[model samples]
Target: FSGTGTNMFKEEGAQQGFSSVTKSIGFSTDSITFGTIENGHLLLFETSSSRKLGEGRDCAYRCQDLESGRELALKMYKITNPDQRRAIFHDLYAQRSQVGKHERIVSYERVIESENTIFVLMELLNGKDLFDVICTEALTEEKARVLFRQLLEGVQHLHRKQVIHCDIKPENAMLLGSLEDGTANLKLIDFGCSCFKEFEADSRGCVVYDSYMPPEHVADSKLSPSVPTDMWRLGCTLYIMLVQRPPFHNDAQTQAGLAARQAGQLFRVPEYEALSPEARGLIEQLICGDPSKRPTCDEALNHPWLGLA
Candidate 1:
C-alpha cells in the first residue's frame, strides 16, 4: 500500500487513527521511508520538491507547505559526531530563545526532531537575493542608499535584541517584495553562526564564513563576536554592491595571511572613482581596517550616503 503514492497521507492515516490534521499537515510514519544521514533526504510534498540552496558545511531545502499553500525554507543538519551535535543543539536552542521579534530578521517557526534528523523551518523570502542582484547589475546610488538603510535598520533591530549576526554578506540579505505602496525592502536570513552577546566563548569550534570575517576576529579570540564585526561585514558588502568586488583579493590560504595583507592596507576604492564623494567617504570609514573606527549600525544609518533623500 505504500509505494511512493501522492495521496499516501489519506490511506495511511485512516489505518492508524491519526486525525485528518496530521494527514493534511504532513508527518512521517512507518510507511515513509527514511533516508540515511550521509546521503541526506530530499523533502517532497504534493506541490513542491526540495532544492539545494547554498554552499559549504550546511544543507538547506526549499519546501512548500501544502496545507498553508506557502513556501518555507528548511535547514537540516546531520551530525554523526555526538559531541559536535550536542554543541550545535545547545547553540540552536539558545538562539531559538534569544532571537526576538523583528521584521528584518527571518522568523523561525518550528523545530522538527526525528531519531536521525533535525530540521529548522524558516520563512521563505520571494525577491532575489541582494548578492545575485548586485552581481548582475551594479546598484545605482539611490538604490544602494535605500537598501543599505534597510540593512542597518535590520542590524540595529538585532543589536537591540543583543544578537550579533556574525555573518553579514550580500548572500544573507534577501530583497523581500516591494511594499504595497512600492518601496523595496530587504530581509536578513541565515543565523546559523549568529550569537548573543552573553553567549560569547572560544571561537575555535565553529566554521566561519571567510570573506566577511573582521580583522579582530582573525587576530584575537577574546574580542567576542560583536556588533562591530557585523559593521565590518556590512562595509564589505556595500563595497561589493557598488563596485562588484570585494576590497581585498589576496588569495591567501590562511586567516593570518589575509590579516597581514589587510594590515598593509592593500584594499582600495580605485574602481569607485566614478561614484559620488559621499559614497566613497562612507566606504572609507566603513572598511577602515581598524575595528574601533568602524561605524556602528546606528552611525552607518546616519551617514550621508545612506542618508540621501
Candidate 2:
C-alpha cells in the first residue's frame, strides 16, 4: 500500500502538522516503454525528450498516448493492492465533472490500471505554476487583477459544485502558456486534497500548507473545517501574487513556524499597507478570524475589489 489511499498529505508532501518534504522525483532522458496492447493502452515515454513534471505520491511524465497519438501528462502511481487501486479509480471517476468542467481546472481523461501500477491520463498544460511566477516574475496591478480574477472564478465553480479545494496554494495554481510571453491563462490543478461538502464532514486531519491555512485547521479543535478553509488559502494566494511573499511567515524553515501556525495568529507586515485599500480590505475579509465571517467564493466574486459578479 502507498499509505495515501485516504491521507492526502502522504502523497502530496509537506503537510501542515506533519514532516517536511525534501527529496524530489528526478527523471532522465531514457527511452522507456510502459505497456503493451494486450495490457490495454500503452504509455510510452521518450525520456530523452520527455520533461519531468513535479512529483507527489505519483510521478508525472510528459509522454505520448499510443492510442490517441496525442501529448498528455501521465500520472503514475505504484500501488501493490488491487483494492486500493480500485478505490483511487472510483474516487477520480466521481469527481471528473467537478474537477474537469471548467477550463480553469485541469481535465481528467481516463484511468488505466495494470498489474501493480495505476496511470491517470490528464490534460498537459503548457505553462508555469504560480509558485514559479511568485519567485521569478514581476507583476503590475492590472496583471495581478487578471490572474486573481481567474483564480476566483475557478473557486466559485468548485463551490457551486459543492466542492471545497482544501489545498489552494500557489503551487496548486498554474499559468497556462509561455512564461516569457506572459499571455497564459490561470488554471487550478491538484485535487488530491479536495473534498465534496458532504464528504468533508467525515474528513479529518489533513496536512496543509501552513501559511495559507486558517486558524481553525491548526488550532481550534471545535471549529469544523469547511468552505472557509478554502477562502483562507485563496487570500494567502492573492497576497503572494501581489507582494511575492506570504502575509504571515513564522520562521517557516523550522519548528517555530509550525508552532506559530498552530497558535492561529495571522498578521500582515508593513508590506500589506502599501497595497491598494480595496485589495487590503478583501484580504482582511478572506482571512477573517471567524470562519463564519469569511465570505464565500460567490460573495467574494461580487466583492467591490474584484467587481467580477
C-alpha lDDT score of every prediction, in listed order: 0.63, 0.64
Instruction: For residues 1-309, write the lDDT of model 2, one tens digit per residue.
Output: 112122332232211111111223484444433433334533342222245677655447786755567887766555566445433533364345446778788877655444444556678887889888878876655677778888988888887777777789998888987534767689998766666554445545433645566766656544445788889888878888888787776653345654654443445666667778888888878866677788988888787777632
lDDT of 2 at 246: 79
Candidate 2 collision pairs? 16-208, 29-47, 29-48
> TM-scores across all candidates?
0.74, 0.75
Deviation (Å) of 294 in candidate 1: 1.4
- When superposed on Cα atoms, how far off is each prediction in RMSD? 8.8, 8.4
Off by over 4 Å in 1: 1-50, 54-56, 79-95, 98-100, 178-181, 199-209, 251-266
Candidate 1 TM-score, C-alpha based = 0.74
Q: After superposition, how far is residue 257 of candidate 1 from its true place, in Å?
A: 5.9
Tens digits of per-residue lDDT for model 1, 99-129: 5257776776555444444445667667778
